[model samples]
Target: MKKSLIALAVIAVSGTAFAQSSVTIYGKADIGVARSIGSDVNELKQAAGSRVGFRGTEDLGGGLKANFTYEHRFLPDTGAVANTSSFFTGRSIVGLEGGFGRIDMGRDYSAAFWTALAGDVFGYDGVAANGGVAGAGYQTVRFDNVISYKSPTMGGLTLEASSALKEAGAKNGSAIRVSYASGPIAASIATEKGLAGQKYNGFGASYNLGVASVRALISKGESATGVESDGMLLGLVVPMGALQLKASYATLEVAGKDTVQQMGLGARYALSKRTDVYTSYANNSKSTAAKKNGIEFGVQHNF
Candidate 1:
């Protein structure tokens, strides 16, 4: 759908609205309880990482714009913020966006995050592998003070890159991603390197088949955790009227020795344009140990 802008009519006499750009406030809050089942262990915990925040945008005119955002997380039920945690504060930053694309400098998501996000059916409901090859059993999230650039789409392809400053005397790792989408087909390639001697590379592709879409990803990674691993994921998301159904399977292999596999299925009901309620379940090799699998039923509102 083409975006539409609505201008409010105001007096020109000492007009404060246009003379200076305006600030907007918006945020999201959600809470839920969760339980996971391992082979021999089972645990329950109050929902965590619920959040809220403020964001603003200003028009400099002439197709130029400036903006800032500050997002934070809190325990809605207990009303507590993540302890002394403001690093990225749940995605805080300042940046600009225009016709040529966008650039932002601050803690950010790497281009490799695509695989991670592919499994975020409920804003990430704690699935093993989190859809990346971060040496298996782990999902690499965001980086700090990242300068990210996104290029305008060209010939059905778009590209993104991010770089973060590693402390001192360190080679800050970087991530690059490229994708092409035309009609019912899309594909992407991504890779990342961590300053702590960790490295990851992967590729993903998707195709629309009638009311459903199919996707797959594969990656290999190394980390100082004495772990070297490889992994892959296969997923399908189908849309049915007001609801969307998702199912996925993933595997993690350790040094060509042991392999752990997982599968998940879920459904999302769109309550409105920017609001949704979802639930999902995951099972892994450890199921025999804690076998609760995992389930989350929650709502998310975005503006």
Candidate 2:
């Protein structure tokens, strides 16, 4: 009888501990058919990078928590890894959060990219994505061996910063972003320095006026050799029940080079809460290069 009582007590303690922690598995599958300007045949593609992820949190006492995330990206069409260099290309991080806010370590998205993403109506997905303009000439979207922090939101404003260590001959990098989001208005400014003194600064803003939401972004980049490039984008999104319309124009200008311009139009219809279908068209033109355009149709499901 004493052994049985002890076993029950242990089981109750284990159950209580288990109740304090939670884990979730989530993923998205997106695929599409696309035809580019120079391609006569359609090709299978991932309109949005497909990914599967696991996240968990443990509730400690005093409102503090421990958290971790692991995400992997893959090509749904061919079942291949999207990033050959890393298994968890989407994100892999462990962090803590509490009244002091959150701090994370490991690979994660850059502050500049996260801030600029708000101004892109397409969320940088699809052929109509404006990420080329938002990122400009900077290529550091996610950094490895990094440490980052995000402050608690105060009156619709928050601050985020990150620093990446130099490894294997790679240069050190750092980024910071300040953002404000409340009601129908959102705005942010961010800057990042990477690789041999190359630097980029970006500003993004959005406003929703019931019938439509308007977004704008501007980015400037300076190369290690001091050459400069600039990019800008303007976008609009309109919603009609389950269907949404999107449009955007973007331009890039580099020193001693002709300006490149792009225009995009797209629409998405929600079939259900977790699934959607979309179509988009994009055209790019430059004074010195031949014009190119593409169109895509795709569907995405979330789980």
Candidate 3:
């Protein structure tokens, strides 16, 4: 009886300890140079992987806990971490989480954008799904003032919603995402629509089957920028030992005429848990447009 009592006490104490004091710093830094061939001109580009997360939690009581997270991105090649105008991108945010799931207010990602990105291969890389010329996605990586809600996983299913406040009469975007993971497979679907002033709507999904993962995405937008756009994306990634293989095809149609199609292939070698070397070759073309065709290759590392 005494041993049993002691064991119970130990378990209780251990559980409490597990609930408190956990501070960890994690980030991913990837560097790669690229070549773009279009208009009889070639350009070289380098970039950094997006990651930098710190989180912790403290038990409150009665199955309740408090938690927080902070994240950011940086360029490893040139050691530059700023906005496009050489000012400050100010790329960092902090938020909290708990039983009702989590509510983050500050400079946070849009539900739609995160959903599209979460379901893509190459972590958005040069894959069409990434949309950002390489991995920027169709819409920009939203930040500013925002509120996001993430519901608890309900039987392998998760839901996320977000809104960025641009105030009354101001153009804003709203997004939602649903995801599920089971066994050796994971999947996510999402949609985003613009409100206030601009207009954007999109759908995306992805699946992983142990050795290979596949992704797809589509988006449309109309805005005061005299804009009309549509896009379709497909991607694949296969793993072989410490090496990974990636391939993808993407197509974009604007208004009812201009079009862009892209195809890319790449390889990644794991150097360690936090480091890898990568190289990719990609080409882009316009079916009925004049955007020209382009190709690229490079390597990357994370730390």
Best by lDDT: 2
Work out how many backbone clashes candidate 2 has.
0
In terms of lDDT, the poorest run of 10 residues in model 2 is 285-294
lDDT of 3: 0.63
* Model 1 Cα lDDT, one tens digit per residue, 1-303: 123222332354337656567666666655444455453333322333556666778877778788777777765656677646673377767888889898888877777776556533333544322444332444346777788888889999999998988766766868888888999888777778776757776777778898898877777777757577887777788999999988887777877754656777888798998787766677776344646476666666766
Taking the candidates one at a time, how many backbone clashes does each contain?
10, 0, 5
Put down candidate 2 lDDT per residue, 1-303, tens digits, no spaces: 999999999999999999999999999999999875445578899888899999999999799999999999999989999999999999899999999999999999888888668767888887778786777767368889999999999999999998998899889889999999999999999999975778889999999999999999999888888888898889999999999999999888788564658788999999999999999998877634343787999999999
The candidates, ranked best first by lDDT, are 2, 1, 3
For lDDT, candidate 1 versus 3, the one ahead is 1
Among residues 3 or more apart in sequence or in different chains, the pairs in candidate 3 whose N, CA or C atoms overlap within 3 Å are: 83-89, 130-137, 132-136, 132-137, 171-197
Compose the digit string of candidate 3's lDDT tens values, residues 72-184. Answer: 55565555653454222333344556667887776666776765565356566642224542222246466566778899998899998878788665666677778777765
lDDT of each candidate versus the true structure = 0.68, 0.88, 0.63
> In terms of TM-score, which candidate is strongest?
2
- lDDT: the better of candidates 2 and 3: 2
